[model samples]
Target: MQVLMRPWGAMHYRIDGPEDGLPVVFANSLGTDLRLWDAVLPLLPGIRAIRYDKRGHGLSDSGGPVSIADLAEDAAALIEATGGPAVFVGLSIGGMIGQALAARRPELLRALVLSNTAPRMGAPEIWAARIAAVRAGGVASIADAVMERWFAPPFRTTPALHPWRNMLARCDAQGYIAACEAIAAADLTEAAASLRLPALVIAGDQDGSSPPDLVRGTADLIPGADFHVIPGAGHLPCVETPAAWAALLAPFLQDHAR
Candidate 1:
């Protein structure tokens, strides 16, 4: 556990693998901390990986207006601070950050992985409704609803349920709403189409938030991106089916590693 203090707020992060290995920076989904990557990390061999909590998630502070660019800058700063440029692995909104960052700062990347995310999320009205809900009822108001969309019926009752449920309930309302706003405002299709880096896109079969076709569409936006869909997994394949997700990711990393 470490903290990277930014002028706006501090971010919690962890770095693993060998110093000399290829560096891969991971950004997690909304309502999750860096722990989002726990199951997937050990499966990848010989790669230096970095994972961080976005502001208001996990141990990071909740301050500043949330924008996709702001989130990208947060990741860029963390990567530059920890170990320079690396492949960026991001999930959900993290994938959105990867797209925005890759467009804004292409030089700071080796390869890119976007998991269970899309070019754009819901409409502005949907985000507005979410912001209103959080403001009226706090993060707890949407915890179960968010979880419902995150995992399927079977996995929802597993031991894994509690931590994520709590993680959502405990998130700072302001920060969570801010993230919702960023998702509402961001559209990365054009930017993703412009990327020249090696890219991989992973989708979970049962993901309602970003369905397999949506994820595939995102992959199609990139010239040579590889796409994989995890069977029996919901939104967070890293949690529901890490091995399968790793099977898809590790090879891509190997193919693109410098």
Candidate 2:
């Protein structure tokens, strides 16, 4: 239950593994917090894994307005605080933050992993409507739809779905809206293309939000980034099938170990 007091607000974060191990910073998706990587972290032991809730998500304090770059700054501060120059793993909007951070402060990262995300998500109109809907009806209004996009059919019928659904519905309305706003305004195509570091891009075959082709396209943007697809999963493969996700990630982390 560690909290980093930033200039804007307080950020909830945690560090796992030994102090001298390689650092791996994880940033979760739009409606999820640091716990998003809980299952995956245990599988990849012996590394200093850092996870944090972005402003407007989880236990982090909400602010007025923000962009992808602003969110990246928060990540940068976290990495620096933890003795940085580490590998960065991000999903959904978190991936966008990774791109912005790589472009803005390349020295803070040793490698980059973009999971189930793209340079730009939906158009402004789509996010605008989502924001309006949440403002009018709260996060529960969109929880079902989000759940549909988040998990594949099989996982949807299991008991695991309920907790994720509740996590989405319980998200802070203003915080969720603020994240939507950031995603709407973000366009990191060029930043992703210009990245010059060890990188890996992954996607779920059934990811409705960021499909395999879209995520593969982001991989194409990077010079030599390897792209792989996780079967029987949706947007959050690390959640739906953590073992398979870790199987892919473990090697990448080994290859880029500092």
lDDT score at residue 166, model 1, on the 0-100 scale: 93
Best by TM-score: 2
Cα lDDT of model 2 by residue, 9-118, tens digit: 89999999999888999999999988899889889988899999998889999976888999999999999898989999999999999999999999999999999999
Candidate 2 C-alpha error for residue 29, in Å: 0.3
Clashing pairs in 2: none
The lDDT values for all models are: 0.89, 0.93
TM-score for candidate 1: 0.96
Tens digit per residue, CA lDDT, model 1, 88-133: 9999999999999999999899889999998898889988988998
Candidate number of the best lDDT: 2
Every candidate's CA RMSD = 1.2, 0.7
Query: For every model shown, what is its TM-score relative to the native structure?
Result: 0.96, 0.99
Which regions of candidate 2 deviate over 4 angstroms? none
For model 1, the local distance difference test gives: 0.89
